[model samples]
Target: MEEVFIAHGGCPHWGKMPTRDASYLREQYPHFGGFLAQRKAVDPDGILLYGHLREMLGL
Candidate 1:
C-alpha cells in the first residue's frame, strides 16, 4: 500500500498516480528544483496547470 511504499522511501512516478505532495517529492528527487524551473520555462502562464497538478507543483 501507499504507507508501505512511503515507509521504504519509495518515490512515485510523476506521470502516474502520485499521492505525495511537492514537499515530499522535493526530498525524493535530487533535481526537483531544476525540474520546476524547466516547467516554468515551458509554461510560464501555467495554462496547462490545473486541479491536482497545480496543487502538486505548488503554483
Candidate 2:
C-alpha cells in the first residue's frame, strides 16, 4: 500500500494509481518545480492537464 511505500522511502509511479499528492511528490522529485514550470510554459492553456492531473501536478 501507499503507507508501506512511504515507510520505505518510495515514490509512486506517475502512470499508476495516484496515492500521493503534489506535496509528497514535490518532496520526492528534486526538480518538481522545474518540471511544473516547463509544463506551464508549454501548456499554459492546460490543454494537457485536467481532473486528476491538475491535482497531481499541483496546478
Candidate 3:
C-alpha cells in the first residue's frame, strides 16, 4: 500500500511558511537575500495549501 501524508502549518494563510517574495525582501532588507534564496531552494516542490471547500464554492 502507498503511504500518504497530510502536512499542515505550511500554508500562506497560516502565516508560517517562509516568504518567496524576493523583491519585497530585497527592498526591505538587502542582507536577507541569501537567507531567502536558501529557503526557496530548500522547498523545490513548492507545495502550497488552500481551502478546498472555499475554492469549490468560489469563495
Best by TM-score: 2
Regions of candidate 3 where Cα sits further than 4 Å from its true position: 1-22, 48-59
Candidates 1 and 2, the one with greater TM-score = 2
TM-score of each: 0.78, 0.79, 0.31
Location of the lowest summed lDDT over 10 successive residues in candidate 1: 9-18
lDDT (tens digit, per residue) of candidate 3 on 1-59 = 01121143232332333433444335545575575456458854534324552242122
Point to the candidate with the largest lDDT. Answer: 2
Q: How many residue pairs clash in model 2? A: 0
What value does the lDDT take at residue 23 in candidate 1? 92
> What residue runs in model 1 are displaced by over 4 Å at the alpha carbon?
none
Clash pairs, model 3 backbone? none
Q: What are the per-residue Cα lDDT tens digits for candidate 2 across 1-59?
A: 77887899878867776767889888889999999999989998999887888887777
Residue range 20-49, candidate 1, lDDT tens digits = 788987888889999999999999998988
Model 3 lDDT, residue 6, Cα: 17
Top-down TM-score ranking: 2, 1, 3
Worst 10 residues of 3 by lDDT: 1-10
